[model samples]
Target: MTLQPKNMLNRLLKSLLVSFVCIIVLSIIINLTAIKLPILTEASYERYLILFLYLIVMIFYVSLLFDQLYLSQKAKGISLFFYLFIMTGSLQLLESLVAQINVQPKAIVDVIVYTLVITSFTVLIFRYYGKGAESYTKRIKNYFSHQHISKWLLKCIYAIFLLFIAHYLINSMLTPFIEPYYNGRYTNILKMSHHAGDVKYVSMLTHALVMVVGFQPLFALWKGSKTSLLFWFGFPLFIILAFQPFIFNVHWPLGFRFPLFIEETLIMYIHAIILVHLFYVPDETHKEEELVKSKLSLSNW
Candidate 1:
């Protein structure tokens, strides 16, 4: 359903406020209940990643809840964007939790249990509360047919996610190859001795750029009303903020400056776009007679 241009901005304001409050509450709860737990409170990198994951979940929850309540178009799109993340994250979280409890390394039973649990939760959320109806889903599918350029851009965007996967896999494989170099030592901060020469500033730049590009589609979904603007202006804005530092500062490359910037920019844009899109884009499809009139169904209202 098309939104009236007049009240669109006002609706977006309300959606943003609601999303902010929800995020705050969720953040507090996560910090209070989960952060203090024995597994999480430890100073492990895995624990830190899990904390970040929880924050990401809270962001998606706010976005999805706003879409469900307000039938926001942008929120719906962002919700779709978050579905992929939530599914993948649920898998990781389940595995991590099971391993923590069992005190085993890559236990098959733990893996299976975690996989099933994550899959079930993801399926339930999508089946019951997913935004946009069947018709809108169809429209999104149809969008792929006509928008070859966008589809290509999406592929380019996905290449970044693939790079991360590659990094993870390569890091694992290289551990065996380079074990002799460090003698399989556990350093407080992981140092790159084998790939010391390979890991240059350019590699760091590539990593940063790939990360930002990875979520461009979600940014696209966020800026649905201004898709062209997002592609043209918003993207540049993000690139400048996320990448400019690495271009300038070359000292202490080991610190998380680049990665943190990428993630921060991602979350900010995600929240902003989710807020604006939620109330501005209504139910995806309008009935034959509904478009002729101003009012939507009582169920929608």
Candidate 2:
């Protein structure tokens, strides 16, 4: 509820400004050190322009989340810090692992520097001057309480598998459209088409877990309905995940971007919808009623 179209300027501008300032610091670091990320393409003015726009959009996405979760809801700074760090860091590390990109310690350090810069700025500025997490506390206490330990594990496993299926299904269905765009442009591309033991699943597993962590605070703290969560939370997330990579690698035709966007965003929104549903644990009033519904089920048998 705190993040409305009219009032989003408060959150969006601050985050972008902070990220931009931090990016300058990061650019300086790259200039000074051997630290580099794995972008195989040479830079051009047009490519740099695209990169610039992508970074803006990416920063806006992150800031939107920061506003909804921490600034508007008053979640803890530690939560924000860890969310930003782990989400971005895990993405870098996992991509390096799965894509088999030859990432070095310097690349990791690059991620760390940017993560810290953005996290510290948001925590200091927003936590200090913002409305605070009164809503976060009230919403969480009102929403969920006791849950079965077994149910927690089941929820995680159930969500991860289903999320992976959604991701795989989308990519597989769209590959016909996307493969044409591959164009033999970049041999250094990801060959993660669905296979028996593709490493992409590993990335999906990590994504599912990270998504769960990210979802919890929002579900508990956000004052919006599931639809708002989908738009505010899910849409922005998928946008960044879908488009951020296109920022660096300029070899592939822009043709793939749309289909790939469809694939990534489609799966991600499904992910958010699933999380929203999965997290809808029974309150105390229905806890007993909701449990053990089937007489011929495994438990009864």
Candidate 3:
């Protein structure tokens, strides 16, 4: 959270190295289990091009994850496990389910194993390359911070509404460009009701809640450093949702998926900055300063 630009670059490169090693190990595991994943085996010009961008995006994501988890707050062992297997895990599971194509038990296990290996290496990279950094100087609070239950619920409702609007409006605008690629397959662009029908609303509800309860550590980062906001929040969400379609789908044209990537990443960034403003706890010093100024004005009056 408090890194110099050069150190940030260093951490990114180191984390990328760790991630590549993890990917190698994961590839061996998948091969041993005899699970053929298109993401690994298939290569095309478009695929490789997107894959290269994905790696660039992931290196920063991993590095930022380290800073947000460690320098932003105290990252306990239990908390690290929760973020890896539970917080981030939920988002991954949702996207993976959406990406399924005749998934077998082995494929499911491969996904779980891949998650384990990559997240585990993320921790190792943090320990060796980033463990002792100074904590962020700002007082940060997120949805998990103490608040009246009713107010917390209001924030959740507001977030859900915002997300729906953002997604609906963005998809509406991009539908023409994106619909060409759908090719009679579920003519609707957003696909909100694709397989789940109305049940997808429940899924969206869970997605909102996941942001509330699972991403407290990230709320501060969302409000910091405008130059990096796209990668800090948007890129990770975009990459997760795009990985299967943009990089792995041999038949799906890149032109189709690229718009979704832009759509989701834009929404994610907007959501992050907005939520941080609406619900996050105020900085302690900033809060005190406001209090003092208010009292001084009252006394003068």
Best by lDDT: 2
In terms of lDDT, the poorest run of 10 residues in model 1 is 94-103
In lDDT terms, how accurate is model 1? Answer: 0.37
- Encode model 1's per-residue lDDT on 1-301: one tens digit a residue: 2446654554454444433443344345446543222223344565544434443343334333334333334434445434433322332232223111112343344334323333333333333343444444444454445446666566555554454444344434433433443333424223435444344323433553434444443333331333332333334334333333333223213233344344435533443343233212223342234344435545476
Identify the runs in model 3 with alpha carbons over 4 angstroms from their true place: 1-9, 34-38, 41-53, 71-89, 92-108, 128-146, 180-200, 220-231, 242-250, 285-301
Worst 10-residue lDDT window for candidate 3 reads: 95-104
Candidate-wise lDDT, in order: 0.37, 0.60, 0.55
Error of 2 at 41 (Å): 7.7
**Residue pairs clashing, model 1:** 72-278, 73-281, 74-277
Question: Which regions of candidate 1 deviate over 4 angstroms?
Answer: 1-57, 60-132, 149-186, 196-224, 227-301
lDDT of 2 by residue, 242-272 (tens): 5555555555456665666566667767877
TM-score of predicted model 1? Answer: 0.33
The TM-score leader among the candidates is 2
